[model samples]
Target chain A: MKELKILAVIAALVGITYYGIEPYAHSVMHPEVSAADFTFKDAKNVDTSLAGNVENGKVLVEANCIACHAIEKAGHPALMPNADAAASYGVVPPDLSHAGRIYDKNYLANFIFDPVSAMHLSHKYPVGGTKAFPMPSYNWMTPQEIMDVVSYLQSVAPKVTEDKEGHKATFEAACGRCHSMAYAKFDATTPKDSIKAYMGATPPDLSQYIKSRGEHYLHSFINDPQVLLKNTSMPRVGLNEKAQEEVIAYMEEIGDSKKAERESLGLWVMLYTFVFAILAYLWKRKIWSEVH
Target chain B: MAEFKQADSMYEWFDQRLGIDKFVKVMMTEYWIPKNINFLWAMGVLLTVMFTLLVVSGIFLLMYYKPDINMAFDSVNYTIMQEVAYGWLFRHIHAVGASVVFLIIYIHMFTGIYYGSYKRGREMIWISGMLLFMLFSAEGFSGYMLPWGQMSYWAAYVITEIFGGIPLIGGDLVVWIRGNFYVADATLTRFFMLHVLLIPLAILGAIVFHFYALRFPHVNNEAGEFFDFDEEAEKYLAGDKKNSKVVPFWPVFLSKDFFVLGFFLLFFFYLVFFHYGFAMDPINFDKADGLKTPSHIYPEWYFLWSYEVLRGWFFEIAGISGKSLGLMAFGFANIIFLLLPWLDRSPMVKPANQRPYFKYWFWLMIADLMVLTEFGKLPPTGPNAWVGFGASLVFLILFIALPFITKAEAKKVGGK
Candidate 1:
C-alpha cells in the first residue's frame, strides 16, 4: 500500500509537470494565429474578421495577397511576373489602387462582374488577346459587394493628374496614326491597316486593345513594356518616369480600383517560433534525455 | 511423482495468498536473489513492461491503420480523433511510448556497460541487445514515414538516399525500396507493412531470445559478485529450499513492477493529454508536392547522433570531398557499438572494480555519443560543422586508444 501511494505520488507529479509545460511546448512548436486580427472580405463582401482585427484591412491584406502583390508600406513584390512574361502567358493580378481612374466605370463593372470575358476575348468583346491566364472569376459576388470594392478603390486611387503626360506621349507615338490626340481623344476612323503605319508600323486596333492584351498583359506592359513585345516596334513608351505616370492615368480610364495587398510578418514569426519550441521540447525530453 | 504433486499443490496454495509482504519475506529468506539489486536492476523490469505496452498499443493501432500513402495519415487521424472510443489517447500513448521505449532501452544499455553486463557470459545478451537496438531503429524509421507529413516525406527521402552513396548498387537498391525515384504511396505502403507487422514480430522474437539467454546466466546484480548457491539455498530460493525466503512472484515483484509501470503510464498520459499528441506532424494532412521542400528537414531525434556524425565528416578532411567523408563517418558511428563486446578486456565488470583506464574510456565514449547527438540536432551552420567534425575525431581517437591504454596499465600493475 505504501509503495502504491509512492507510485501514485510520482505519477501525479509527472502528470502535473507535463501539463504545466504542454502549452509552452505547443506554443513554441506550432504557433498559429489565435487572435481575430486577419480576415478575407470574400467576393460576398462578408467581413471575415480575425482576433484583434487591430490593423483593420492591413493584416488580412498581408496574410492573403502580399506574397504576390505589394501590400505593406515597405513591402515590394517578390515574384511579380514582369510585363513581357505576363503578356506572353497572360496570367497576372494587376496593381489595384490606381485602377479606378483608368477604365470607365461601366467597363470596370463588366470586367469585374465577369473575369472570363476579361480573360478570354469573347464575341461580345472580341479582340482575342494572345495572353491567357485562368484568372478565377468571382461569380459568387453580389453587385453590392462589387460596388463596395469599387468604392474602396476610389478612396485610395492615386490622383488623375499624376499620370497624364505618359498617356499623351503613348497616344501620340502609337495611336496618333489613326486618331486625333486632343483631350486624349482618338479619331476611331482609321482602317485596320497593314503592319507599317503606326509609329513606322501599323499595329492592331486600339478599340479592341484592352480585349486583346487583357488586364494582366496591359498591367505588365504599363509596368514594364520591354518585357512583352521584344523586337516589335511597340516603342517602350510609358515605362519612363513621365510616360509611366501618364499611361497609368490613361489606363485607369478603363480599369477598376482595388485594394492594395498586405504583408503580415508578425504572424509568420509567431508560427515559426511556435513550431521551433515544440520540436525543441520534444527532442530534449525524448532523445536528449538519454545524454544527460 | 507424489512429492512433485505435493510441491505443485503447495505452489497453488501459496499463489492464492499472494501479496508484497509474503513475497518480500520469501525472497529474503529463500530466493537468494542478491538483496543488492539497485536502481539499475529495475530497468530490466521497466523495459519489459514498456515493451508490452508498445506491442499492445501498436497492435490496436495496426488494426485500423492503413499503410498506403493516401490513407495513412487520414486513418491515423480518424482513429485518434473519431473512430475508436478514446482512440486518440491510445494512438498518442503508442506514439509517445515508442520514444519512451527508446529512452529506457538506452538507459538499460548504458547501465549494462557501467556494470560490465556485456562481459564474459553476458556477451550473448549484449549482442542481442545491440541487435534489438538496430531493430528498434528500423522500426522507428519505418513508422516515422507512415504519417506522410512534411518532415516524414523529406527525412525518409534523405535517409533512404544514403544508400545511393554505395559504389555500385546503391541507386538501384534505393529505387527498389521506393518503387519510384521518390518516396510516395508505394513506399509508404511497404514501410507501413514492415513497421506494423514484420519488424515488430522480429523484435518480439529477438526479445524472447534475449530474455531466454539472460535467464540461463541469471541477472548481473549491482554488486557484480558471482555466486554459486548450495542445494539447500537453491531450493530455498526456488521456494522448495529450506532457510530461504522464497516469495511468491505474484504481488511481490508483480506489485513493484505495476507501481513502476503506473508511474511511467502517468507521465505518458500527461504528455499525450496536455501536449495535444506526440510531436510528429500528420505528414499526410498536407499534400505531397515535390517542388516545395519543407523549411527544415531532420530525422527523428533518436537518430540525431548518427546524423551529427554524418554532418561532422564534411569538415574533418578539408581537401577531401565533404560527401564521402560524411558518409564514412556516419557508417562508422553506427557500427561502433557493435564492436563493443570485443573492445574492452577488463577482468572485472563492476565500475567500482574496473581499471581506471577502462573507466576513462567508458565515460569518454558516453561523452562522444552525447556530443554527436547534440551536433545532429543543430542546423549545419558556420562553425558547427567544424566543431562536430573535430569532436568526432577526438572521440574516435579515444575509442581506439582506450583498449591499448588499458592493456598497458594492466601490464604495469601486474609487474608491480
Candidate 2:
C-alpha cells in the first residue's frame, strides 16, 4: 500500500506536469491560428474573355520586361547583370523563365499591373514615398496588355516534370532568387547585401527548412506570409498549390532524404528489440525458477 | 579453488592463470542481495545499460561528426542522417540514449534516497553516483554544442555566460571555458573533445568506484533490513535456499533485473522508433546564426528544474543583483544533491514509507521539483515568475529544514 502510494504520487506529479500542464502552457503560449487559405481569394480575378496574342505578347515582354527580368529560355539575356541591377534597385529581379509555370496566373497578372499594391507592400512603398518600390507599376497599360505579358511568360516557360529533379527546378525558380540551397550547391541569384537591405534580415538558407519549419507550417507560411507572422518582409511568392508542394518536396529531398529509409528501418529495429526483450524475459524467468 | 585444480580444458587453464573462477565467485555468485527490493532497484542495471548504449552510439556518431562550426551541422544533419546507410538509426539511437539515460539516472538516484541507501557505510556509493550524474550532465551539455544548431549555439551561449556572474574572476572564467569571448569554432572543438573523450573517461572511472563502494555495505533492501551476507550465502549454498534472506547476485538478483531491463528496452526503443521528436528539438534543425536569437530559449527537460531555480530569483536582495543570486541558487541546487548523506540527520534505516515526517518531506521535495521543472520551460513573466519563486523557496526550505525534521524524528525514536 505504501509502495502504491509512492507510485501514485509519482504518476500524479509527472502526469499533471507533462500531459495536463505542459500542453496547457504551450497552448497558452502559442495559440493556434486558423490554417492559411491556399486559394488566392484576395488577388484580382483574371478575365478569361481577354484573349492574348502570343506573338504580340512576346513583343511587349521584350520591350518592357527584358530590360530588368531575364527570360533566358526565350533567348533574351538580361540587359543588366545581377550585380549592376542589385546595386541600382537594392534587389535583383528574378528571371522570368519559370514564372508562368510556378506563379498563379491571376497573381502574376495583378503583380504585373501594380507590384506594390498586389503584394500589399504599399505600407513599405507608398506612392510618392521616398522608399518607393523597385518594380515600377505597369498600371498605365490596359488589362489586355498585362494578360498578354502573363500569357507570353506562360508560353516561354518550360513544363516542370513532377519528380525530385522537377521539384528542384520549381524550388530553384520560386525561392532560389533569395534563398540558397547549400546541399544542392545552388546559390541565391540576389547578392547577400542587396537582399539584406531589401528584406531587413538576411533570408535563411532553405537547405534544412523542411525539418525546421515542418510541412504544415511551410505550407501556411508560403501560402500567405502575413498569416503566420505579421509584418514579415517575405512577399508571398504566389506559387499555385502544386508548385508549392513541389518546392516543399525538393526541400525534403535534400533535407530529409533518408526519411523513408529511417522510417522502414525503425520498424525492423523495433521488432528486433522487441524479440530480444521477450527472449531476455524468458531467459530471466528460467534462471530464477531454481532460486526458490 | 576446486574449479582451478586441473588444466584439463581451456577454461581450467585460464582459471589457473587468471583466477577467473575466484573473481566470478567474489563479484557475482557468492555476492548476496536482499530479496525485499522492488523493480526500482533494477534501475542501477538499467542505468549501466543506458551508459553502454550511449558510449557505443556516441562512437558511431563521432566517426562522421565534424567539430568545425561551419561543417558540424551538415555533417550530422545531412551527411550522416542522409548519405550514410543506417546513420540515421545510429543518430536516433544516440540522441534518444542521451535523453533516456537521464530518466534512468533520476530513478536510480531517487531510489537510493527513498531507501536511505546513502546512510551508514554507503556514503561513497551515493557520492560516486553523484559524481557520475554531474559527469553525465557535463557530457550532455558538451555534446549538445557539437551539432551547432540554433538552440545548440544559443544554449551554449546562455550557459557559458552564467560563469560570468561570479565575483571577480567571472569574466575570465567564461572566456577560459569557451576558449573565446563567444561560442565560436574554438568552443565547439573543445566541447567536442570533452563530450567524446574527457567526461566519458571520468564516468567510467566513477562507475568502477561506485560498484566497488557497494562491496563494503552491500545493496540496500526495500525494507532496509540489515543482513549478514556471508552467513546468508552459506545458507543458500548449503541447500536451504528457501529460508535464506538473501539471493546470489549472479542468477537470482540478476533474473529480476533482466526482467525489468526487458520492459525498459521496449519503452526505450518505442521512443527511438516512433517518438523521437521529443528527443530532437525542431528548433535545432536550423543552423546556428549568432546575429539572430530564437524567440524562446530553454534547456533540455532534464535540466529544467535547476534552470528554473536559476531563473526563479526575479528581484535584487540587499546589494547582490538578482542575476547573481539566481546564479548562486542554481549552483546551490546542483551541489546540494552531493550533500544528501550529511543533511538527512536521520537515525532511521528504513524507507520513507516507514518514517512519517520524512515521507511527506520526500513527497513535497518531488512535487516541488516537478513544479520547478514545469515552470522552467515557460517564459518568466507574471504568474510563471511567481510560481517559480515559490517553488524555489520551498526547495531551499526543504533542504534547510531537513536536518531539523530528521533529528526530531531521531529523538522521538530514542536514538542518536
Candidate 3:
C-alpha cells in the first residue's frame, strides 16, 4: 500500500521527464541537417508542357508505345503474342488504330501520368481475382512526350466522325481504354467472359449511358465519380471544366438521342404522384373522423 | 419479455448442458485481480484490441495484396488505393495500427516496471513478452517489405547485410533467407507469408501462454505484494488481518479497460481520417529500383534506437571489427530487458516508488532511449555520432551496473 503512492508519483515523473527533455534533446541531437529532412516533399515544382508536333509524335510512338500497340493494324505485332501478354498481364494491349477515336484527350493525358491512380483499376481487379491492371506506369515520360504520343495516337486513329458539333475524337481517346461501342472491333466477336476477365465487372455498355444517367449527372460525374458514391472505384479523371463539357456533349450525342422525350415524360409521373397523395390523405382523415 | 437481467438467461439453455456459463464465469465474471492495480493494467486490454485491429484489417488487405514482386506495387497503389472499395481506409488503419501497437508496448513495459511486474514467480510472463517483442520486430520488418517499394527493397538489403557480419555461416544464412542472390520475387513471397501468417500465429500463441502464466500469479499491483492465494488462506486461518478486496473482473476491470480502448480508438480514427501519412515515408511510394539507393536509409521509428547503437560501433575497436562490436551493442541494448528479471538482485518485490533509486534510473533509461532514437533517425556523422557513441556506451553500462547498484540499495534498506 505504501509503494502505490510512490509508483504513481514516479510514473507521473516519467511522463514529465520524457516530455521535458524531448524538445531539448531533439534540437541538440539533430542540430545539423537530418536524413529525414532530405525528402521530395520540399522539392521545387517544375512546369511541363504537354503540347508537341504530330510528325514527332508519330516517331515517339513508334519509338515507345508501338512495341505493344499496332498503330497501322498490320505492320507491327506485339513483342510477345497476345495470348502470352494475357497470361502475363491479364489484359492484352489493345490496337492503337481506334484509340484517338474513343478516348478524351485531357483524360488521356492524365492517364499517362499515373495509370494506376488515374484509372483506379486496383480495387476493380484484385491480384487473385480474374484480373488486375497491367499497365506499366510511364511516369518518366515528359509532359511534351505524353502530348507527342497523344498526337501520334490521334494522327493514326480513323475519324469516328467528321461532324463539327460532336465530340467523337474526345470520346475515342478517353473512354475507349475500357468501353467500346456498337461499331467497335470488340463488340460482335468479343466473348462475354473476356470482358469480365479484364474489367472485373463488365462495364455497362456505355452507348446508352446518357439515357440512363441524363446529361447533367454525366457532366458532374465525368470529373469525379467519388463525389456521388464515396466508395467508387473510378478515379477522379481530373478534366478541366471545358473537357468535362466536351465529354458530356459526346455522351449526349451518341448515348441518348431520346433524352428530351424521356425528361418530358418524367413531369407527368411526378404530377400524378402529387395528386394521388393529396387524395389519399383526405380519404384517410374522413374515414377516421367518422369513426370517432 | 421485458426482463433483461436474469441469473439464467437465453444462453442458460445451452449452458446447463455444456457447462459453458461456468467457463465464462471462471474466465471473466469470477476472475480475481488486485484492487490496487492502476490505469497501467489497461494496457493488456488495449494491446489485445490493437492485435485484433491488425488481424482484421490485414485480412481485408490480403484479399487484394499480390505476393509477386512484378505486381506488388500495383496491387497496393493502383487496385487497392485507386479501385478497391474503401481499400485506402483499411490500408491506413493497418499501417497506422502497426506504429500505435509499438507505442503501446513501450508504455506497457514502463507500466510493468513501476509495478515490478517481472518480480517473484512472474518471470515467465516477462520472458514470453520479450519473445513477443522479438517476433513483432520481425513481423513489422516483413510486412514493410510486402509493398516492394524503394525503401522496402533497400531496407531488406541493409538489414540482411547485418547478418553477413557473422564470421563464417553469415553469408550462407543471408542467401538462404533471401532465397535468392538478392531481394527479389522469392523474398517477397517469403515475407508475405511470414507477415500474414506465421508471425501473427506465433504472437497469438505467446499471448495465450503469457496470460495463462499470469492466471496462477494474479496481476502484480502498485503494492507489489506478490501474495499467493494459498498463503492468503493460511493467513486467514491464523486470524491475521487480510485484504482480499477485489471486484468482479466483468464490471470493474472490464469497464476501465474498454474506456481506455475507446480513447485510443478515437486517436487512431483521427489519424486514419486526417493525417494517415504522418509516419509513412514518401520515399516508399516509388517502385523498387535496385540501381538507386536513397541518400539515407534507416529502419522504422521503433528500431531507430538500436540502429543508432549499431551505427556507433563504426569507430575502430582494438580486436573485433566495428560491425561485430556494433552488432553486440545492438543485441545487448535490445535483449537486456529480457535479463532484468534475473539481473535485478533486489530481494524486495516492491514497485519502483518503493525503491530509493530505481525510479531515477528508469527515468534516465527513458531519456537515453529517446536520444538513441534521435541518433538513429539522423545520419551517423558529426555531433550525432559522438552522441550516438555516448548513448550506446551508457546503454550497455546500465545493464552491467543495475544488479550491483540494486543489491547495495537493498543492503542499505537494513534487512527489511
lDDT for B91 (candidate 3): 77
Please provide, for model 2 over A1-292, each residue's C-alpha lDDT reduced to its tens digit, 9 standing for 90 to 100.
7656766765675577665234665566566777765556676644535877778889899899887888889997877877788888787888899998888887888888777766767667778889878888888878888888888888989987789989999998899878888888888888888889888888889888888887978988888777777877888778888899999999999988878876787788778878877887898778766665
The number of clashing residue pairs in each candidate reads 60, 0, 15
In candidate 3 the C-alpha lDDT for residue B217 amounts to 69
Compared with the true structure, what per-residue lDDT tens digits does model 2 show for residues B347-398? 7888897886789999899889888988998888998899999999899899
Candidate number that wins on lDDT, 1 or 2:
2
In terms of lDDT, the best-performing candidate is: 2
Q: What shift in Å separates residue A125 of candidate 2 from its native position after superposition?
A: 2.0
Can you tell me which runs of candidate 1 are displaced by over 4 Å?
A1-292, B1-33, B229-232, B235-255, B276-278, B281-287, B315-320, B352-355, B412-416
For candidate 3, write residues A122-238 as lDDT tens digits: 566455676445666676877777778777776776544435244655564456445655422334122445545654555445644553355655655665564544455555544
Q: How close is candidate 1 to the true structure, as a TM-score?
A: 0.57
Report the poorest 10 consecutive residues by lDDT, candidate 1 chain A: A254-263
Off by over 4 Å in 2: A1-16, A19-29, A44-64, A72-90, A141-157, B1-6, B413-416
DockQ-based CAPRI category assigned to the predicted complex of candidate 3: incorrect
The DockQ values of the predictions, listed in order, are 0.02, 0.50, 0.02
